[model samples]
Target chain A: MYGKGLRALTLATLVALTATFALVVFWAPNDADQGFIQKIFYVHVPVAIVTLVAYVVGGIFAFKQLRTDDRKWDVRSYVVIHIALIFNVVGLLTGAIWAKASWGHWWVWDEPTLVSFLIVFLLYATYQPLRFSIEDPERQARYASVFAVIAGAFVPLNFMAVRMASSLVHPRTFATAEGGLPGEMMFVFLVSLVAMSLLFWLLVKYEITQKNVTWQIRALRRRLLGDDAVAPIGRSAAPTIAPEAAKPLGQRPRVSYENSPEARSRGPEEIAT
Target chain B: MRSREPRPMRPTWVLLRKDLLLERRAPESVPAMVLFSITTFVLFHFGLGRDEVEGSLAAGVLLVTILFAAILGINRLFVSEQAEGGFDAVLLAPIDRTALFLSKAMALFLFLTLVELVAVPAFAILLLGPSPWDALGGLVVVLALVNGALALVGALVSALAIRTRSRDLIVPMIGLPLLVPALIAASRSCAPLLAEGGASWPAAKWLAVLALYDLVFGLLAYAVFDFLLED
Candidate 1:
């Protein structure tokens, strides 16, 4: 079920991303002030936007996890956050590169946006460890959901506070002497945004489907060859979806170990002996 | 239904009283935090190689010291509960689960205040270039606001980390970043008060930021705490 739309989504992401690159290179006008250097904005800003939005979406999934006590939602939240953290690294690296090209420095403390993102990056870097340290799977999911919710709320508020504290030493990305992004640049920016968002969604869906598939395979092996056929999951921070929960109840294997051919051949007496 | 149900505040007060009484009897967390704060001051004195620091430097040193000291207190906030089966005991009680969060945050707030009482004066004497008297009033307000931010974050982070294998490592890693906005606002507000010319009132904006931060985190911590308490 999780994989139902994954292929189409991935195809769409690839198409849109390719189109975005085309638009950025050929259509978007160079900034009057920064010239070719500002082109990085098309990639950097969209990734940053998608990263932040992914975090909030992860929080929403976490909220659902808490409300329903469903392990699947926890799995979804974990995947979303895990991917978003990767996007965060991409965003930071791209931002640093852009800063160095434009401002002659790899970093600038005066840019509130950059600084706030760095703080957010540092905060979320602990999420995996937080999940890993709790031995109980249920407790790990619950606590992580709580953390996601809190950190989600913290994002916008932190941005506001940091921005308010630091004045505009760094130029505003969208606004300029021209009174805002030009129509061409804005179009390219919107296209890039859609592409990045699609990519983020595709990754999340792909991960959830992969995890569900994993659990279902294990459940099948357990059903066919008996419980000992499957290895136990070791300590992990990632949430594990119960096999039955990942699929419709009707689709589950009808023959369990007790009712299998192996069990019939062995018989109760042979096992007892 | 049970014939008797305790009032909500009753549980909060009971827990608060228990923590306070425990601190009074043993006096562990507060003393350690105070000592840590004063020692940080001494280290800053030598590290900066300046007999005195004022303005933003003074604010940064003072707030950073108090912030780290508060982290020390945060690490210990849940030790007793975790070690002595207090969490299970509370789970068995009929009272609201948020009471645990409330009492613990209040306990930490008090501990931070106690540390500041000695540490702030000690800061003025040791490294602060400006006279302490002029800045005392404004400094108090700034510290009080800073303390609230620390307390709320401390309580939440402590609960989050307490059951983890590496509780100590997890606290500062998570807590410090969550706290940076508050630190920025507080230090900025305190800078003018610590300026060499004389102490003056902190800007209204930084105070507002601190207040907003406290309010946001306070509600966030309260709402999210019950999940942490699930058995």
Candidate 2:
């Protein structure tokens, strides 16, 4: 089911990304003030927006995972966070490149937006370590959800605090690319946002489908070569698929939570290592 | 195993009392916190090589000292619980499980207050430029709210790191970053009070931020705690 819309989403993303790249190089007007140096805005701003939105979306998925105690939602949440971290790195790199180009510094504390994003990046960087430290899948899922929820709420608060402090001290507005965007620029920016968001979704979908396929392959090996043939996974941060779900291609009962009662809940699949 | 869950605060009080009694009998966390504060004060003196610290510098020293000492308490907070199987006992108890969060937070708050009692005086004698008398009254009120927020955050971090193998390392890594907004608020509020001219009242906005943090995380932790304890 996760892979069902893959072809369409991938095609759309490819079209959008290509179009965005071409438009940035050709059609989008140059900034009157910052000039050619401002072109980085096309890549940086959209990636930043998508990353923040993806983190919040990850939190929402985590909330649903908690409410339903479903591993699928956790997987979705994990995938979102994983992808967002990658985008976050892109945002930081592009930001640094922009900063060095404009301000002559690789980093600047004067820009609250950039500083706040750094803090957010530092905070979310811990998500993986926290997940890896806990070996139990169920507790890991639950605790990780709690962290995701808390960190999600913390994001807006951190931005507000940093913004307030910076504005009070510097009294200088480091206008983001969106501020006072002209009609032509706004059109280009909106297109870039769409393109970046599509690319994000496509990558997430591809990752999930890839995970699903890996699971199915493992199921096949278990059936064809017997259980003893498959070596086990060691302690890991990745969400464990329910054994029934993982074993289906190998002929195990696929009594999923969708149809099962609450009492039918089972412990997480064996590590088998 | 929760059964006939009638008493909530009663278990909370009992647990608080138990932790207090234990801390009193052997004196594990609070004493070490006091000592750590005094030592860090000495370190700051040599480290910064400043005779009289004021304004943001003073605020930074005090906040860092308190934050680090609080980490000491937080690191040890769940030790008794984790080592003694207190979590198991709590789950077996018929009372509400939320009491655990409340009691742990309360215990942490009290320990923080005790640290502040000593650390404030030490900071005054050792490094403070403005007279302690100038802002003592207002600072306490601001700090009470700040302490409340830290207590909630400390407990959440404690619960988070307790079950992990690298709890000692994880606590500070997770906690210090999580405490950033609180740090921003507390240090910013304290800066004006510790400024060179004279100790003055803290701005109301920082206190509001602290209060909002407490309210938000207080509810967030309570809601998610049961899941953390679930088997």
Worst ten-residue run, lDDT, model 1 chain B?
B1-10
- Show model 2 residue runs off by greater than 4 Å: A168-179, A242-246, A249-273, B1-7
Candidate 2 lDDT, B78-195, residue by residue in tens: 9999999999999998878889999999999999999999999999999998887887886797678778878998999999999987889888888888888888888888998889
Per-residue CA lDDT of model 2 for A39-101, tens digit only, reads 889898899889888988998988988998867778788889999999999999998888888
lDDT of each: 0.87, 0.84
For each candidate, what TM-score against the reference? 0.93, 0.92
Count of steric clashes across candidates, in order:
0, 0
Error of 2 at B112 (Å): 0.4
Across all candidates, the chain A TM-score values are 0.88, 0.87
lDDT minimum window of 10 residues, candidate 2 chain B: B1-10
Query: Residue-wise lDDT of candidate 1 within A1-273, one digit each (tens)?
Result: 447766778789999999999988888888777888889999888999988888888889899888878676788789999999999999998889888988899998778767878999999999999998988988999999999998888888888888887778788867778698778888899999999999988888778777777777776677789889888998898885462345434554545434557644642222211
TM-score of chain B of 2: 0.95
